[model samples]
Target: MSAVPISEHVALVTGGARGLGAHIVRAIAAHGGRVVINYRRSADAAHALADEIGDSALVFGADVTDKDAVGVMIDAAAEHFGAPVTTVVNNALPDYSFNGDGRSHADNLTWTELDAQLRGIVGGALNTIQAALPGMRAAGGGRMINIGTNLVQNPVVPYHDYTAAKAALLALTRTLSHDLGPDGITVNMVSGGLLRTTDASAATPDAVFDAIAAATPLRSVTTPAEFADAVLFFLSPWSRAVTGQNLVVDGGLVKN
Candidate 1:
């Protein structure tokens, strides 16, 4: 069994001011966990979320891609909550639009675009994991959940750069789970399909959403709150023995 209970966890959620990240933070806080809301440019939203969450939440602005900033944020969060952050939700993403027409064609995509996505996905996860390692080791156990996408499996839109980066993140999630298992830190991923209406998916046409819902077994697009509930499972004691796995929470849009 996991040593820590859900109530005792101090969770740090990157890009946790609005959208899916905010929902994840709300889920954690609702379960009695202290939450650290990390944001890069959404300070107002972050502060508002913290205010709404009250004492159980702390707001911090730090770009996850900046190693030093992430390190500092981890330390500060530990001090604020009197416990090191025991749960990390890597939910940040580079500025992206989901509109297929707006996306760069495969032939037109540049290495720069790909690199930028990789940095936000893989690079951010690397920074937070490394910064929180000692704390998780000391806490006896911890949970790490990386937000992923079902597009990695289907890739129906051919978002080459985005899907490629998330694929890399999945690889990192598995390898790190192996590397960190000895420390009692379980790493896993929760992949969702085009969320009903996250900031990134806001640009998606209504027709696209309708098509996705029609294809899914549930006959509906997964909402942010629904996907966040899956993340909560990874943080709970029931998932103590589950790690290095990716659970797709997309209304069965793409079965793994």
Candidate 2:
């Protein structure tokens, strides 16, 4: 595809300090967009990545679960960057609640744990979208991409809370797309299976990884960069007509 002209557009990515979020930030910068890297606790890493990327990047520290904090982060990003944010990638997740440890099933999971997970995933997206919408509407157009999971479609290794939250996010994406379409805003989702060896997934066992890979049609695990590519597509003009869709980037692991 021909390069998308993202020059002068400001993009905000939650959880942009490392892993998949970092890759998404880099990809946007590579495509000539200015990026605001948002993180909750990885301030050092966030600043380092922003510094490494030079003036086109800035780091904002905010817990996505907190609406007020998220608004401040978004406002600060717009003030620091020349353009108001016209693109948003909701990739920030709470520390993983699911490992292969088998502790995340419905039986063991408490309502409090489930509520926390849902709030982080669903509430975060809503907060950021609310903060960014006015700027986008004023600018005449924008894109919102919410990161989700393939497990919601095929729950092979069940993490009830995480999957349920992501499923809610997908539903939110569709509803928001319809609600905001008339105002020149688009909402979409990108879902992926277990990515290999990111800091978040480091505790996952080798055998579990192998089993997922074996079951995937591609017979391999995906990388953070590969997942970032899908996010980039949603930001590009090619996907202008696509909204309220969940694009799965799991190497055909869950064919729906």
Each model's lDDT: 0.92, 0.87
> Mind giving the per-residue lDDT tens digits that candidate 1 earns over 15-38?
999999999999999999999999
Candidate with maximal lDDT: 1
Model 1 pairs in collision: none
Provide C-alpha RMSD values for all models, in order.
1.0, 2.1
Listed per model in order, the count of residue pairs whose N, CA or C atoms clash below 3 Å is: 0, 0
Candidate 1 accuracy as lDDT: 0.92
Q: Write the per-residue lDDT of candidate 2 for residues 1-256, one digit (tens) a residue.
A: 1223566568999999998899999999988889999999999999999988999998888998888998888889889985678899999997764555755665677888779889999999999999999888888888899999998899887888888899999999999999998877889999998898688787788998899899889999988888888888888887878899999998889875
- Report lDDT (Cα) of residue 85, candidate 1: 88
Best by TM-score: 1
For model 2, the superposed segments whose C-alpha errors exceed 4 Å read: 1-4
Q: TM per model?
A: 0.98, 0.94
